[model samples]
Target: MSSRASLKANLQLFVTRRCQLRCRYCPILKGDSLMPLATALKGADLLLGHQSGRVRLDFGGGEPLMNFEVVREASAYAARRAKALGKDLGFYMVTNAVLLDDAVLEWAAKRGVLLEFSMDGAREDHNRYKSAYDRGLDPYAATRAGVERALRAGSPHFVIVVASPSNVRRLAENFEHLYEIGVRRFDLSYAIGGVWSADEEKSFFSQVELVLTRHARELDCGAVQLGNARQRLEPTVLNSELMVDPDGSLHQMSEWMFETTPPTGEAPFHVGTLDTVKDINSLRWSRFHSYYTLVRLYDGRPDVRAALLNNISFGLRVGRFFRASGARLGKVPA
Candidate 1:
């Protein structure tokens, strides 16, 4: 590892592979295997002990609260270690909001941990796709209570809705529905790992236009901001977020998102493991970090290639729309 003393290390940990719901489009779902406490602590040390002056730990999961012990303990450990090392530290949790409770909400508020919620607009639409269809549980119903509690508790948070071909037509209605429920900020994203047809693209843009029109005033006032006008207009397959999986293994976010059915390796995505990596500089770089490389590595899989290209296409088109519509989008908070 290079002695980059001023580097910032931001590590995202997948504390558990267990989830309560089986969303139709999720690519990272797996059995209920939890990350051992020792594994998570080692991961914390990788960042806290690094030369980085600033460090952040973001926790996600099949459902992180399912392994709340690790999330809570490792986070506390990291905070203390970072403080002792005279490093800046921050935390965030990406979750479905189904498992939130008073304890979690209070802890997040006190710790200043940003809670990123994954919810797709309305109940009917959410349950239709994001539901635990196998268990006949309504995901929207399960998460709404927790979301409300967090809002009341004043937890630092925002909501993200992933729009796909299946739900593009209802995007406007869904965005409106979320607003009615008191969510003031959002990140609207197109679903990846699948195709979006011509009609779907047109519908998606129209829906976005409607959302902008309805929320224009709030957007201009910065009361409610769309976080992704800048981010959404690019290829996300080679995302920059570094991911730490349950087994203490590390990979790039591009590789981690598709963990369920991994792509053929033109080059390995296993950058390093927490067991050995002591600094972010020690992390190995993968050839699959580029769109061109991903295209070659994902050969013979036309669907995946098409989806990747479509995502980039969406970015360009959306960027045009943002400029033309004069939509005011604020920078997404870190």
Candidate 2:
């Protein structure tokens, strides 16, 4: 379908704030306030009200699998509503997989929930970075078990790997390892709120681009494209997806939506909540979000525009200055 004509195809709904795993880089929770299940259901209803016939919802959470009952109940309700309203229904779960179980998988299969497992690579590679020093549980094993369960249930599955300074050097090995283990689809996202700095984040992006460019043929053998937060900035993909938080806050993109730090201050990222947005233009459209949006919105105002231009210029100057010094600026192939 053409971009303009396409109705929103997907939605990510945060069903709960609770999680079983304590991954080091989770950006969702501030403390421990879990969104009530009633509120979550209302949020789903709000989304369905907005795009009932066309939207497919993906269950999200601190660990979506941790709230298996909510996932199952919400799916059933949505499916029934969609069917009655003559709208299409689709479901997916973004899970740590630590708490995924056969009963949950069976229920999901019956309700038709697509499963996304957080498996970076082999147990050793996955554990190296995933182990929560305080939690003392193996995330690698938990993820592996979840993937196995999904495979057994014959559910479509996706694997997500978060790239950082610690993992960039091992991209090839990680990709190869997941492929060998029967994971056909995968995604790569950046680690948020970790020990990495801006330079490290930029370098990680460069490395992923280079890896894909150099090994496109081998890596492209997988069923899904390796994607990240920047994927939302691409115009072709924007209308096709939506990121709804646990409280039912809707975002234009999933990854960038969560990592959203307000233009200033300590806000993680987001302008407002889903309940408040009444039009398409209310979406957070950052100037540097993508080339298309940047060009379209560049009006050279005294405030917003000048600030954006200044920011861009400063980044460019910094890059040049870094090159002049002994600092490294990694390059990714086109």
Candidate 3:
């Protein structure tokens, strides 16, 4: 599908705010509440029942697998709904894979859900930043176990190696290690919060070039798809990323872009919810989020205002990197 089509068809339904890991680079809102099964069922029905045709549903959250029961049953409900209506349902769940159990793996294979595994390149780097809150537990070990299991099960999977200041220079090395471990699909993700220096950006681009060169070199052996390099950029609003919080409140993807926690004290850009939004196509979307809006909306909280500004800055840097490289809209391959 075209980038615009993808933007139009996608929906991010967050299952739970609870996660096992307290990653240094994560900015997602955290809580113990899982999206009620009724909410998930309703959300799926509302999304798939629409006239939009094929629906690509990404179960978003603080480790979707942390809320395993909801993820399992809700996904099944969506599949059944789609089949009954003769519609295509592209199911996906992005996970740390720490809680990826046998049942989830089996369900993914049976339902054709594309499982996106977060293995931040090298083990040291992964364990360093992507570590669980419990220091004794090695997140890398669990990630490796889950990924290897998925590989053995013939589960559709991809590796998301985040390139942050902590490990931007080691990206190529991490990429190599992952490729050695049967990672044919890669999303060389850039950490999207504040404080990327000019030097860090330069190093990041250089590492990306090296990784691309390696991919080109290995083409004769087999296809190793670089997920971000193969996208088509476009001027878009909310279609590409719309997240429904566990409370059934819907917001654009940008509102959650931060590091460690939500800076605004509350989520921004709440478009609508499943309760009231019958047609997503009818929602009013525009350039509603900016520094000006932040200033206006967050007059009382300077710290919140400052953090949000940093987020915007970081986002623009990533955007410029993609625009300069001409990777269509900087999406991880549609």
Candidate 4:
């Protein structure tokens, strides 16, 4: 493995597993456990201490707003620590936006925290999968209101749309609807671990093309951000993006939810604990880091990178299916 002396790392802090909404596609449903303030600060310290350049710290969870106070304190601490260490820091939060109100928007705006909302398209499509536990609560309406509030407050925010079988056909319409509602930026993603039928796959690509064609101007002008398209077009070396769990355990961003038992069965994805480890140099980390470095070495060849990502995604989907089936059959090892 090469020296990570100059590499900047992105840290995702899963502040809490508590969320108010019951989104059908979310991997984590519910949990009362919240990351302690001390653990949150420690995780920030670990990232700042190990990385050299600008460190992007993202506060995420079932819903980060459930523990907004901790996020605020930790962000302040991280800002001070980064200043003292002569490193740059970027703060972000991922939320469903159901709880985003004027006060929350103002707080985040004042602190320069970039907010990203998980909204699936327009009201009808969005309500199809995401909603509150009460069943009567309208998640789509709340999210729309929240976005409007954020725009009124002049806060920096963006939208993330998850493309599933149900919503694939409406992708273009959704993008247009969001644009009509004053959302200028977007991050589009697709669901993994599901087998797409022939017709579904065709529709997915067609919708993607339609969206790209309709938004070509915005995309070219840098007003929109499509995660899947960007990955496919401009592939970069996967940097060490660390996911710090609520318990303060460290994991790769890709292996965030599978910290206990990675699907690969090679080894636990547990790189180290934020409380005990001073530096991240575990074998697993080293291997992944080196692999990404090699990928970057082929930067000019996007086909190679695309193929790599496709293969990896396929393998992960298979692994997910196997694990799910095993649990269903009572064959998962205890």
Best by TM-score: 1
Cα lDDT listed for each candidate? 0.76, 0.57, 0.71, 0.67
Which lDDT tens digits does candidate 4 get at residues 1-334? 3463324366789999887787766645377889999999998887787545777789998789889899888988998989889887888889888788877877787678888888888888888878787767889998888888887887887788777776789878887898888887676555542445556656766776677667666666566555443222111122346678899987655432222212333333346788667864332344365345435444554644454465355434433433343212221111
Runs of candidate 1 with Cα error greater than 4 angstroms are 1-8, 133-136, 229-233, 262-266, 284-297, 319-327, 330-334
List residue ranges in candidate 4 displaced over 4 A. 1-8, 223-240, 256-267, 281-334
* Alpha-carbon deviation at 85 in model 4, angstroms: 1.5
Each candidate's clash count: 1, 3, 4, 0
- TM-score per candidate, chains pooled: 0.89, 0.66, 0.84, 0.77
Clashing pairs in 1: 233-315
Tens digits of per-residue lDDT for model 1, 254-298: 664455655665633346687667777656443235454466557
The TM-score that candidate 1 achieves is 0.89
Off by over 4 Å in 2: 1-9, 133-136, 193-334
Clash pairs, candidate 2, are 260-268, 260-269, 261-268
Worst 10 contiguous positions by lDDT, candidate 4? 325-334
Task: Candidate 3: give the clashing pairs.
Answer: 26-260, 232-328, 233-328, 233-329
Report lDDT (Cα) of residue 213, candidate 4: 69
Winner on TM-score between 3 and 4 is 3
The superposed Cα distance between candidate 3 and the true structure at residue 243, in angstroms, equals 1.5
